[model samples]
Target chain A: MAMTEMRKDDDTALDLFFAEARQSAPEPSAVFLGRILAQAEGVQAGFCATPVQPAVRRGVRAGGLGMLLALLGGWGGIGGMATAAVAGVWIGFAGSDTVAQVAGYAMTTETATASALLADGDILALAAE
Target chain B: MALDALDDVSDETLLVLYGNGDRAAARMLTLRMGPLAFRVAQRMLGDRAEAEDLAQEALLRLWKIAPEWRTGEAKVTTWLYRVVTNLATDRLRRRRGIGLDEAPELPDGAASAVEQMIDGDRAAALEAALAQLPARQRQAVVLRHLEGLSNPEISAAMEIGVEAVESLTARGKRALAAILAGRREELGYGHD
Candidate 1:
C-alpha cells in the first residue's frame, strides 16, 4: 500500500512538472513550412539534373575511343618498322634468288628506313645519357 | 472538423502522399507536428529565436527525407523531437561560456491576453532553474514532462536506455525542485 501510494505521489509530481513546462512552450510559426518547401524544391531541382548521366557515358566512350586510337597508332608504328626491315633485306639480297624471295616475303617499304635508322648511329642517341 | 479527424491517416501514409508530391500532406503534417517540435526545442534551448530555427531545420530535414522515408523504423514526431533536442543541446553548450545576466528573457506572458495568467518573474525563475540542469538531464525532463513522451519513447528519441531516461528525469526533477524551491513562495507554487 505504501509503495503504491509513493508511486502515485511520484506520478502527481511528474504531472505537475509537465503542466508547468507545457505553459512555456510555443507553437511554431507558419514560415517554417515555407522554408522546408523551398529546401525540397532545391532537392527536386538536383534530382532533375539526373539526365546528365548520358553525357557522362558519352565522355567515357570518347575517352575509350581515344585510348583505342593511341594503341592502334603505337602498333601501326611497330608493324611499319618490321615491314621496312624485311624490305631492306629483300633489296639488299636480290642477287641470291633464295635470299631475295625470303626477303620479299618479310619486307615492306616502311621497314627499310627503320632498319637503316637502327643500324646507323647519331639518330638513335639517348636523351639523358 | 477537428484536427484529430486526420489522425486516422497513418504518419506513413502521409509520408507516402508527401513523397508523391502531394503538398497538402506536407502542410497537414507540418501543422500537426510543428508545434510539438517547436515546444520541445523551446523548452530545451530557452530561447524563442534559436528554438524556432532548430524546429525549422528539423522540419526541413523531414521534408528532405519524405522521398525515401521508411515507415515503422521510428515514429516521425519522435525523430523530429530528437533532432530538435540535439540541435538545442548543441546551441546550449555553445552558449555556456556567456554570462547569464545578458541572456534574453523569454517573452513576457502578461503582455498577451492568452498568457496573462502567468507571472513573468516566476516563469523566468523556472527557466533559470532549468538552465542549471545538465543538457541531457534537461532534455530527459523536457521530453518526459513538457513534451509528454513515454519512457520507452524518450529512450528511443534520446538514444538511451529506459533506465537512463528514468534516472535522468528523476535527477532532473529533483534538481529543478531544489532550484525552484527558493522561488516557490514568490510564485505561489508551494501552496494548494
Candidate 2:
C-alpha cells in the first residue's frame, strides 16, 4: 500500500514537471525561415522555366536544317541542267554510231537521275515516317 | 487557385501545385512545415545554431524533392521528420563523447508572462533534468510529453516499436522524478 502511494506521488510530480516544461517550444529563427523561403522560390522558378525549352529547340534546329538542304538542292539542279544541254550538242555533231553511244550514255545518265530522284523521294518518305 | 482555396488542400496537393510553379503553395507549405522542422530539430539537438542549420537543410531537401514528390507514398511532415531526425543523429555521432551539462535554454515564445513570473525556475530545472537523460529516453519523453506527439508518431520518428516508446517514456519519467527529488527545495516542491 505504501509503495503504491509513493508511486502515485511520483507520477503526480512527473506530470507537473513535464507540464511546466512543455510550456516553452522554441520559435524558429527568422534567418532560417528566410533561407528556406528563398530556396522554395528558387525551386518554383525552375519549375516555371523548364517545360517550354526542349520543344522550341527541336523546332528551331529541324526547320533550319530543312531550309539549308532545300537551298543546296536548288543550286545543284542548275548544274545538272547545264550538263544535259552539253550532252545534247555533242550528240547532234556526231554520226549515227556516235548517236547510239550518245543515246546509251543518255540512258545511263537518266538512270542516275532517276536514282537521284529516288533519293529525294527518300527525304519525303523519311518526313512522312 | 486562391490562397483561401489552398487552405483546404492536403500537403500532397500543395506539393503538386508547387511543382506546377505555384508560388502560393510553396509559401503555404513553408509557413506550415518550416516551424515544425525547426521545433523538432531544436528539441532533439538542443543547440540553437545546429538546430537552425538542420532545419534549413531539411527544408532545402524538401524543396529539391518537390518536383518528384510521390503523391500518396508518405505524409509531407512525416518525411521531413525522418530527414531531420537522421540529420540530428548524424550530428550527434560526430559530436560523440560530449556531456550534456550545458543544456540549451528553451525559447520563451510559448511561455506566457505569467509562466515566466511564476514557474521559470521549475522550467529550467526540468530542462536540466531532461539533459541528464540518455539521448533515446530524452527524445522519447520530449516527443511524448513536451512535443505532444502520439506513441505511434514517436515510434515512426524514432523508428522503434510502440512498446519500446512506452518503455522509454516510462523509464525516462522515473529517472526525471528521481533526479528532481534531490532538488525539491529549489524546485519548490517540499519533500516529506
Candidate 3:
C-alpha cells in the first residue's frame, strides 16, 4: 500500500512537471511572424494568379469541338456523309481516273447522238435500199 | 471574419482562410500552431535556435500546402507535429547526440501558470531525464505526457502501431524512473 502511494505520488509529480513545462513554452517573436506572413502572402498571390484558367481553357476548347461534331452528325448520318465525300472527291479531282471516266462517258454519248443524226440524214440512201 | 476575430477559428478553418488569401488567417495560424511546433522541435532537438528554424520551416511547408488543404483529412496540429517529427529526425541524424546537460530546460527564473503548481528543480530534472531516453522513447513520452496526446494520435505522428506506442511510453517512463529515482531526495521529490 505504501509502495502504491509512492507510485501515485511519482505520477502526480511527473504530471505536474509536464504541465508546468507546457505553460512555459516559448513563442515566436514579431519579426519571425512578420517574415512568415509575408511569405504566405507571396505564395498565395502566386497561387491565385489564374491557376485554374488552364483547365477552364481546355474545357472551352473541348466544348467547341463537341458542338461542331454534333452539328455535323445531325446534318449527315454516316452513309450520307460517305456519299457526299465521294461526290466532292469526284468534282475536286482535276487529274484522276474518276474524272477521266466521267469525261469518257459524256464523249461516247455525244458521238452516238451524232452518228444517229447522220443516219437519219441519209434519206436518199434509205429510199434506194 | 475580421483579423481580430481569428481567435475563435480552428486551425483547419484558418488554413482554408489563408488559402483564400486572408492574412488574418496566416497570423492566426502562426500564433496558434507556431508555439506547438516550436516547443516540440525544441524538446526533441535540445536547441532553441534550430528548433525555431525547424518550426518556421514546418509552418512554411504548411502554408505552401494550404491551397491543397483538404478539410477533415487530418487535424492541422497533427500534421504539424508529424512535420516537426520528421524535421527533427533529419536534424538528429546530421548531428551527434548531446547529453542531458544540453537539454533545453525551461527558461531560468520566470514564474508560469504551471510553474507555481510544481517544484521547479524537479521539473528541470525531469527534462534532463527525458533527454537521456532514446529518441523514440523520448518522443513517445513527450507526446504522451507533455503534449497529452492519445496513443492513437502518437501512433500517427510516430508512424507506429498503437501497441508499439504503448510499449515505448511504458519503457520511457521506466527509464525516467530509474534515472530520477536516485536523485529523488536531492531533487526535492522525496516526500512521497
Number of the top DockQ candidate? 2
In candidate 3, what are the lDDT values of residues B1-192, reduced to their tens digit? 577888778889999998987877777777787778888888877777888789889988998999899999899988988889777876765563454335333223212222333454655666666656666777888889888899999988888899999998977776666666655666556664
Q: Model 1 in CAPRI terms: which quality?
A: acceptable
Q: What is the lDDT of residue A63 in candidate 2?
A: 68
CA lDDT of each prediction against the hidden true structure: 0.68, 0.75, 0.74
TM-score of each: 0.63, 0.65, 0.66
Give interface RMSD, every candidate, in order. 3.4, 2.0, 2.1
TM-score of 1: 0.63
Put down candidate 3 lDDT per residue, A1-129, tens digits, no spaces. 598786777676566666766776556677766776677777778766864643444323356666775666744565689898998886886567768888999999998786677665585676578
lDDT score for residue B144 of model 1: 81
Off by over 4 Å in 2: A1-3, A51-129, B98-120
Candidate 3 deviant stretches above 4 angstroms: A1-9, A50-129, B97-120
Report the Cα lDDT for residue A19, model 2: 81
Off by over 4 Å in 1: A1-14, A40-50, A54-129, B1-7, B97-125
Displacement of residue A6 (Cα, Å) in model 3 is: 5.6
Q: For model 2, what TM-score does chain A reach?
A: 0.36
Residue-wise C-alpha lDDT for candidate 1, range B1-192, written one tens digit per residue: 234555678777777676766556666676666777777877788788887778878877777787788878988878887888888877876777643333333223212222232564555565666766778888888888777789999999989899999998987776666555445555555444
